[model samples]
Target: MDEDSSERRWEDMELDILVRIFKTFNIIELTSGISRVCSTWRLACSEPMLWKTLDLGLLKSNYIKIPAAPYVWVSDSSDKRLMRLLKVALGLSRGTITCLIFHYDLYLKDEHLIYTAERCPRLKQLVLPAWNQITKGGICKAIRIWQDLESMTMPSIVHPPYIMEEIGKSCKNFTELKLMGPCDVLFASTLATWLPKLKVLSLRCTVLTKEALILILDSMMHLEVLNISHCVLREVPEPPAPKRVLLELDETIIGKASRLREFYTCLEDSCLMSQRTKADEGLIRWYKYEEWLWRMDEVSSLSVAMEQHVEVGGGGSIVPS
Candidate 1:
């Protein structure tokens, strides 16, 4: 080894400069790399501040051989090793780690959850896909420890009563919430009542009936924005009213185009009532494609003739452009 060249390497990166370099790596990676460069480097890498924000997703593929899907993740020894590694990672720098993202399956045991709750006492934001994994008791326990929790994005929350009453009641500063997938009238209404101070609520691809929708709207009157995008809606069957109405409120408000200021389904089904023409007995052709368009054009003309602008029933607000 060239002593002169080796000594010169310290000019660019002294002990402090090397600690800064070591801080960029994760707890596991930094420990291994620094341990190789004699005992002194190992001591420097063990600095608690160097190991904040432990991202378990980064170590998903290589260390654990964990699959993206739950069904595919092999419940073998390697998986146990991965969980142990997570625990060790958490243990190494609990005080320093303010942010921890596990972009993988949370098939964690109860002890693990308790350990995690203990370690990440000040965890402010959490994003977990399977809320079912964490029970109402577990949630309450975690929140009891973590008073600083501000944001959470969980999918398919089964225990709303516990979360709304217990956890939310405890966490005074809690603001943002994003619950994804199917949620019924009961759950949504409960949330509106519980989280009165909630600023942002995102029901991801969740379906809501018109009646259920109204209940929510009335409850969350302070709501600034609402997103029901990509959500399903089952049409409510109603007794046929007058010959026609101007516009359908339900259709316009939730469905169809973006410029929808006022929403209702009034224009009628263009397909069912379409004109069918028969030129001769022998020819099986009904109406030409262009002929149907012409018929719709006539319907539009008739609708226009009835009312240049139809006033909504019960003196409701007029339609917007």
Candidate 2:
């Protein structure tokens, strides 16, 4: 056989075959490795199926806490690296990304958020856990651009009305939401006012007030699923009276939630998760515990898939170069 006939060129491979091979590659290899080999490989890397969900769940910022607004100070190098990763990933995605996932520690600035929003115009689901660096205006702007957004896993904010109103006004298809922090009266009331039609909500491992819980159960008549597993449920009496911690839901609360398709509540003191939530002051220190603990949710739609882990440079680590 002739030497040329015996040897096959990767460039000469079919696009379908290349795409199938590319499926095994993680975000790093797809962004930094194969795409630069040649124009054919570049075209394969740009395949729409390859860019549907950009999960940066492994990437985190190196930062220190400061006594100022946006209190955490992320290193300049970390910010630049994130920008580079976003530029490459979004450029190759070609606006086909429907779901975007970020690590709970990957704090992003206004510039990073807006840049992603502008590029991912078709984004339907977003799981962004940290809002320390992002401002209300910044998040609102991003939400407006994501007009098709259907679900989100976000950190609880001081003022929830702005973001809720933005989602209500922009995302008509919005149905699911998960808050990773304490839910107060204002936050619960804001959700009821702006997103009464919300279907699924998860306040797993967070502090949920009795008033907030009751308000949510009563107001969100269209709610199909509610998860408050491992939550620190509290009851506040009339002014001047101290708030009391409740170990279990009362008959009234349970009856009110009976109308929902799924209502998850775990208040057993023996349960490790329940203990952890109580010990940590309603916020589970996920890093110290199992990483999967934070991602666990009784509501299927609100849970993050563990399979989307991004491998960096042939290693198990998710550090992007």
Candidate 3:
């Protein structure tokens, strides 16, 4: 190397130039070591622009299936590791985070949710696909904290009224929702009652009843976009009769949905996603199928982006800036 080039130090670079360079690094790379190089680099790492969207889509919990209520036993080491990572990320973010994304397999506990809620006061969007360990109270508390929340992607719960009520009361700006499980009549009714003004909804790859679909279309007057792609639409019958699966939407449904700006549906037998949904009996067994399919959504805003993986030392622990 030339003497002049060797004499120049990275620390002498302008902060704006360093921040622009850091912007290209992924979450793992940013939290791994670049910040520790110098005080100036550390300042660049803490810049609000770099922390606005904290996407932990690649991080998943280490757990084993159990035959109990929770159905999975997450190791203490795994929980601690997640907590440590959250501490480092949230600490550097300094309450500037607006969007947060989590992997569908990353089962988070109440403490983790609460810790994140307390830090990300300005959070506007969240995509948390797994909620096996999260309790109703824990979710309500988080909702209360995230009053500015506008969009979410979550799994369906057993009883939906309580959470819907909480969201209605707290997140006035909330308009978009994506469900990763069946949407029964009760769930649809609860949404109509609480979030009637919801603008965008995605019930992709789930069981959706004909009555529920109609109710949503009729009730959500302000709905602008709806996605029922790859859904197993069914009609429940009276006593002594079995539910019948629907192959196509009748004129009634088509006419009502025509008013929406964007309505997505795929029920063709040749469609791979539709076949998968039927084979899995409405609830998709994501682990048994293609990984990308589970994260794909008809609504572009709800789709998960493909991220690059990077290997680091210290058992992959995320180091703070």
Candidate 4:
């Protein structure tokens, strides 16, 4: 390397400044693009502290345009590019990755998940919304490897017992679970049976039966945080008509579950209206509106789903007249 050019590059962007800039870029750019620039950049990207939480969701917005479905037939070229990116990112992480989040549209095969599980042995939290392509064997393999897994936000499956049993047997520290579909009696019973000591459970935006919910609250003795906001909890006859009501936790049930630090429930018609309008307007993309809602209101006890993209006038709701 020429001394004059090297000196100019260093003066333009120092190593410390370069590290800060690289941190802002998503995993795709860091693994596939930035690190390939030079040896120095690659070294910086390999820093363990920077690879703690590997979020690959931004790649859907940047490169891959997946179909609007749970699973898609990824083109050969895109598949190869994805594998290459994962390999590079996991290689850089060096088994220190604690959290791994995949986009809802990013259809992943068994090989992709296995490769990830092998690389990220210390994985604790995983947010995978789409699992249509992943087989039972694939997920079980990953669970066995990720024994330290604590929290997971995933799509609901038809058969819950297998996965619940696998998680209970393998992941001893698994306490937090979030389901993205209907929470029926079967799901609740299976969960209570296998994971009675569960702490945090998020069933946001799902269709849950009040009986099942109450059963969970009554059965899961060590339950702490329960998030059922935005959920459609059974239908009831509200005098004039049969209106779908959220599971109303009266003072008795609430008092019984006093150990719970947070209990999220959605009964606000305004919030539901805003969500329906947004969905109709095609503003909520990537089949992940529920996930976004949960993230926005996980902390607040009484959070209304207010759309921030557009402005509201007089009324508190975001719906327009």
lDDT of each: 0.48, 0.86, 0.86, 0.71
Tens digits of per-residue lDDT for model 1 on 2-79?
666544553245667777877665545553344446656655655666665555433323322222322333345544
TM-scores for the candidates: 0.60, 0.92, 0.91, 0.78
What is the full ranking by TM-score, best candidate first? Answer: 2, 3, 4, 1
Off by over 4 Å in 2: 2-4, 60-72, 308-321
Which residue pairs overlap in candidate 4's backbone?
A: none
Model 2 CA lDDT for position 54: 90
Instruction: Write the number of the candidate with greater lDDT, choosing between 2 and 4.
Output: 2
Model 1, position 50, has a per-residue lDDT of 64
Ranking 1 against 4 by lDDT, winner: 4
Which residue pairs of candidate 3 clash? none
Instruction: For candidate 3, write residues 1-321 as lDDT tens digits.
Output: 866666658988888899899988887667667866888888888999898889877543233333443355667777786787788788878999999987777788999999999999999999988888899999899999999999999998889999889989999999999999999999999999999989999999999999999999999999999999999999987868999999999999999999999999999999999999999899887766654566688899888775654433224444442
Per residue, candidate 2 scores C-alpha lDDT tens digits across 170-238 of 999999999999998999999999999999999999899999999999999999999999999999899
lDDT of 4 by residue, 69-188 (tens): 433455565556567778888988889899887765667888999999999989998888678779999999999999999888777789999999999999999988877677878999
